[model samples]
Target chain A: MGGEYLANLADSLVTVMDKMAGLTCEWSEKAPQLPAITEGVTVVSLLGFTGAEKGRVVMEMDIETAQKIGEALNQEELGPFDKMIFYALSELSNIFCGAAITQINNGPRRPGLRLTPPNILVGEGLEIFGERAHLETASVFWEGGLIYIHLSLEGGAAL
Target chain B: MIREHLQVFAKASSDVFASLGVQAVHQAPLAPPDSFFSRYDLAIIVGLARDLRGSVVYSMDTETALALAGQMMGGMSLPGLDEMVKSAVCELGNMCAGSSVCNLPGLTADITPPTLITGSKLAIMAGSDNVLMTEIATSFGTVEVRLGLEE
Candidate 1:
């Protein structure tokens, strides 16, 4: 995995979070590991990219943090995790993924990648698995809470 | 368009299962759409892009998943959802989605690697509420394939 690619993705995530949700978040230097949330609800949103190269971006966070971010984006108090909140988070995931892929497309690789609509999964004690691919995991944190991003670039057109 | 896509997907699934030496019969979608919460314990979601873009989710119980994966692995008796089992299941999803998109005459699309999710009380929203779901009864069990393509 190229550092420049990772940097572009991380920068896009930070910029999008700050600009879209008015939330200041940064990619942590700590080793990327999916957090263990044995209890409580976890919200995971995934988007895939296709073109010269293929990959995916997964954004995951606890429901409380998701609701808080939703409130921030909607600029109003949300009443108990409803459909609006789910849409807000799903759109946020789309924005984050779009930003990251845009940066990559404009970068040196120029992998004219197109995005698929985001899929939002809400559940408790959920375990996600995507093996046999090059994976790069990172964590993004904000004042509200933290979320994990997993990027997997599978076999496709050379990067 | 939705019905056409569903038919293509069903045919592709039947072909894939036939190639695997398994008998899979496509049936009408499971009725009373339960919205998002899935009744099955395992789901392999594959995102499609280009001409037909959205998601194709293969949902089934653990036993069905194990049986399908086992068939893919040359009829091996799988125990649980181990790493190998999970990989095989994802590949099965990849095959089904890939085949379906390719068979969509006059449309060219690509599929992202499958994302496998397993747990209790699972609810999934893929792109929109307009999802076409159907069941394929195999010798192993019933597998539901959900096509949530963006209009």
Candidate 2:
């Protein structure tokens, strides 16, 4: 995957987050530090994509940040780490992934990328494997908290 | 129809575990649990569409998940359910569901991405009552498999 494709994908994610959750997000100029598990309870959602590009996109944030986003979207206070909050986060990740894939395949070269339903992980001390792959990470500041979006493209070129 | 589907799923589960070098034996089918809460701490739900419209949930406790993940990673010691372990478990569920769909002849359906839920005393409402519940005994621990299909 080209850097331009990854940049477009990051832009698309920010757009979706802004529109869906009413949260202002932009790609951080400098690489932000990944939150330590001890900082708070973290929730990570993974969505795998296949077609012209094969890899996984991960959305990570603290539980408090997730609840805030969910409450804003639903306009209701949600319990910390509640199932509803998890579902909302999952749906948000789904939309973000869908939009990013569409943005990547918008040009003349169609990736024909298809996304799988999101898989969510709610816990601390989580580490994903993609060491030998092309990894692109984007950190966005939202409402004083940071949301990390990582795209790991593995062994696929734009068709 | 349910039995046929169960057979495919059971074979798939066995094959997946065998591939990971872990022996898993199909146990007797059990009655569906009234509440998923307090039953297991970690669960992976794989949604199926088309000919069979529903989900397949693989439930196990935290220890079982850690053990399974360790085995999947060639017996690497895991302190907690980190990202790597979680991904390994999710991939296992994906593989099992993919194999089941492939083995079930004439069952045209698509598999959704696997969803992993981890918490204590969690409750999940199935879409339908038509569920095939079975237990599998593995060297590490027991895994409860619930296949819920919409009629």
Candidate 3:
């Protein structure tokens, strides 16, 4: 149940990212190709959930690729998110956690819930901690297309 | 008031990570509004529920963490988990939380335990946030972190 929920969360997130950033966003059952380099641009953002359950939500992306997303914020569609990786990454996390926290706070079924701003991770040659689950997934694109991925950590904690 | 303070601490987190050449996205990026459990590895997070109403978490993964510790030690190769990484990751959380205490609007917060998660087994308790975790596509695999509130 928890794992399924995590996957669903990832899907919902894809929706939000697509609507806000307009990346032609989609998920993929096929694995995402991990290039030798992280495409010279990756935006990562996360939020903290405290009380009872603890961990964080982190989002990563390629900068050059991000720039290609043209989501109109105020009647202005920006170019590739490559240059604004940091800004795009942080703001995106904020949005994700903001909604998550709100739901947690309001859900009677949920236990204690709280959230913090996303703490972004930036660098080159970052190593993977564990086996990549959901490495390949069925993704629904805003364009009603489909995509795949190498993996997506969605929400997880080390045991 | 608490919101503003949270912002300050959020910036502090970014600053610390930036020093290590990482990014810390705050309330803007959307950390997955519909997911449960904000994810972080080897992190120390605290809440300012009383005077101020917000929380903060400091994070780093295995590789980047070791690298940061190595840099602190003046270019020493981090073969594996060592005291350097432990202290660095912990202190990062401490600094961010503490800085918020002084920098934020109205409140003081105490520290909390720093939980370290390792291996492939990750536990994500059911959760959904206003914003989803920010996805970072990098040369390596994707790495993400998030902080959320329940107000």
Every candidate's DockQ is 0.82, 0.17, 0.08
Model 1 bad stretches (over 4 Å)? A35-39, A155-159, B30-32
Chain A TM-scores, one per candidate? 0.87, 0.86, 0.58
- lDDT by residue for model 2 over A1-159, one digit each (tens)? 545655776787788878887788888535543333224466776666666655667677877888888787777988986777777877787787778778777877787776655555555444344422455667777765777876666653431
Q: Which 10-residue span in candidate 2 chain A carries the lowest summed lDDT? A: A29-38
User: Which of the two, 1 or 3, has more lDDT?
Assistant: 1
Fraction of the reference Cα-Cα interface contacts (below 8 Å) that each candidate reproduces: 0.83, 0.01, 0.03
Tell how far residue B109 is off in model 1, in angstroms: 0.8
Candidate 1 lDDT over residue span A51-130, tens digit each: 87677777888888888988988999996567777899888888877877787788776879899999888888888887
Ranking by DockQ: 1, 2, 3
- Cα shift from native, residue B104, model 2 (Å): 3.4
- Model 3 lDDT tens row, B34-149: 43333444434443443444344444466766765566566678788754566555555555566656765554543332333332222222112222233332222233544444
Clashes of each: 0, 4, 103
The TM-score values for the models, in the order shown, are: 0.92, 0.69, 0.46
How far residue B105's Cα lies from its native spot in candidate 3, in Å, is 12
Best of the candidates, TM-score: 1
Higher-ranked by lDDT: 2 or 3: 2
The CAPRI category of model 2 is incorrect
Which structure among the candidates has the greatest lDDT?
Answer: 1
Task: Please give, for residues B6-103, the per-residue lDDT of candidate 2 as tens digits.
Answer: 77888788889888998899866656656434377777777665577666778888788888889988898788877778778888888888999899
Off by over 4 Å in 3: A18-39, A70-88, A127-159, B1-151
